[model samples]
Target chain A: LAKTTQPISMDSYEGQEVNITCSHNNIATNDYITWYQQFPSQGPRFIIQGYKTKVTNEVASLFIPADRKSSTLSLPRVSLSDTAVYYCLVGAPHRYGGATNKLIFGTGTLLAVQP
Target chain B: DAGVTQSPTHLIKTRGQQVTLRCSPKSGHDTVSWYQQALGQGPQFIFQYYEEEERQRGNFPDRFSGHQFPNYSSELNVNALLLGDSALYLCASSASWSGPQHFGDGTRLSIL
Candidate 1:
């Protein structure tokens, strides 16, 4: 498993775009970048995931570079409801023998969306 | 469809006591994983159970044990608890080991 680093906090205004970056210098070939959003008193919700290049979903977009050392989660036109802690994790999807892939989480980036 | 569900949203315990937390995986899910989250910190993996067997474990101690039933529901048992054990325990479920995990709100355990 590779260790990840992310910003402790970020600020955004309503209807603005917010980008949170995470760095994983020792990412393995099988590893993928996953971003999760957690609201207060709630479990983390899956946001976006990517291996290399770019991947987009209805909620967010993930951009990975050729090096795969880092990833950026982009949230477009943010709202107050989007204020939450965003976590960046790096891990393989699964191991052999049907063993599950355990998620490794960092302190995460606290996105404070102000009205 | 209902997502992952956990039991006893809040609990209080003292030193050397034992506590059990329950979790029901999402519909059609077979794999369950447990995590512990301290205040202002990221969740840490405890272990994962599949097919009524312990498949993977984290850096947790033997005091932290788990059981998975045939229905894919799971229980997390912690014995001889310490104040440091106080945290929000989260349960996540996935259709398979390769699928994305869905998490429950977690059971908040406070150790005095």
Candidate 2:
């Protein structure tokens, strides 16, 4: 499993864009960078996932540089409801021949979206 | 469809007692995984079951064990529990081994 490092907390105002970066220096070639959003008392929701370059979804966007050692999760036009913890995970999508695809969440960055 | 569901939203147990928590996976999911979350910390993986067998596990002790039934529902059993075992036990269900997983509300276990 590739250990990830991210900010512990971040603060932003509503309607502003927020970007949280994660560092996974030991990322493997088969690993994918995934981000999840977790609200209080709720399970972590999948936000975006990408293997390389950029991938955009209805909720968020993931940008991975060519180096693959780090990635960033970008949330556009944030709202107070978007205030939650965001987790960054780096692992492969396969289950066999390596560690299980179990997600190991970090402390997460507590994003406080002010209104 | 109904998402993953766990039983006994909250529980209180004493040290040295055994406790069982139940989880019903999502409608189409066949794999179940358990995790333990302490306050202010991220969840730690306990184990995962696929095809009604224990597939993978974390560093947790043998006192923590799990079973997955044919229906894909699962049970997490803790024997001779200690006070430090108090935490939120989470159950997640996935369609395959590496796909996205849906989680239940989790059972908050408080050991006294």
Candidate 3:
């Protein structure tokens, strides 16, 4: 598993675009970058995941560079409801066993959305 | 469809006590994993269970144990708990080990 470094906190106004970058300088070849959102008392929700280049979903977009040492989660037209803690995680995709499901979470970046 | 579900949303315990947290995996899911999240910190992996067996574990001590039933539901047990054991324990389940995991709101345990 690789260690991830990211901002402790970020702030953005409503309807603005917010990008949170996470750096995993020692990312492994089998590691994938996954982002999750957590509210005050709820479990973290999967936002987006990507290996390289970019991946987009209805809720967010994940961008990765060729080096794969980092990833950025982009949230477009954010709202007050989007205010939550965003976590970036790295893990190897499962091939045939259940051990690959273990994920290490860091002190994720807390995104505060201003109304 | 119902997602992952956990039990006893909030609990309070004292030192040297034992606590058990329950979890029901999502529909059609077979694998369950447990995590612990302290205040102002990220969730830490505890272990994962599949097919009624312990398949993988993290850096957690032996005091923390788990069991999986035939129905894929699981239970996390912490024995002789200490004050440091207080945290939000999360349960996540996936259709398979290769699938994306879905998490429950977690059981907040406060060990005094």
> Per-candidate DockQ versus the true complex?
0.72, 0.52, 0.67
Regions of model 2 farther than 4 Å from truth: A97-100
Top DockQ prediction, candidate number: 1
**lDDT by residue for model 2 over B14-105, one digit each (tens)?**
99999999999989888899999888888899999988889889989999999999999999999999999999999988877456777888
lDDT of 2 at B29: 84
TM-score for each model: 0.96, 0.94, 0.96
Model number with the top lDDT: 1
TM-score of 1: 0.96
Fnat, model 2, is 0.42
Give lDDT tens digits, candidate 1, residues B1-112: 9999999999999999999999999998999999999999999999999889888899999999999999999999999999999999999998665667889999999999
**Winner on lDDT (2 vs 3):** 3
Return the candidate ranking by TM-score, descending.
1, 3, 2
Model 1 DockQ reads 0.72
Better of 1 and 3 by lDDT: 1
What lDDT score is found at residue A62 in candidate 3? 95
lDDT accuracy of residue B53 in candidate 3: 86
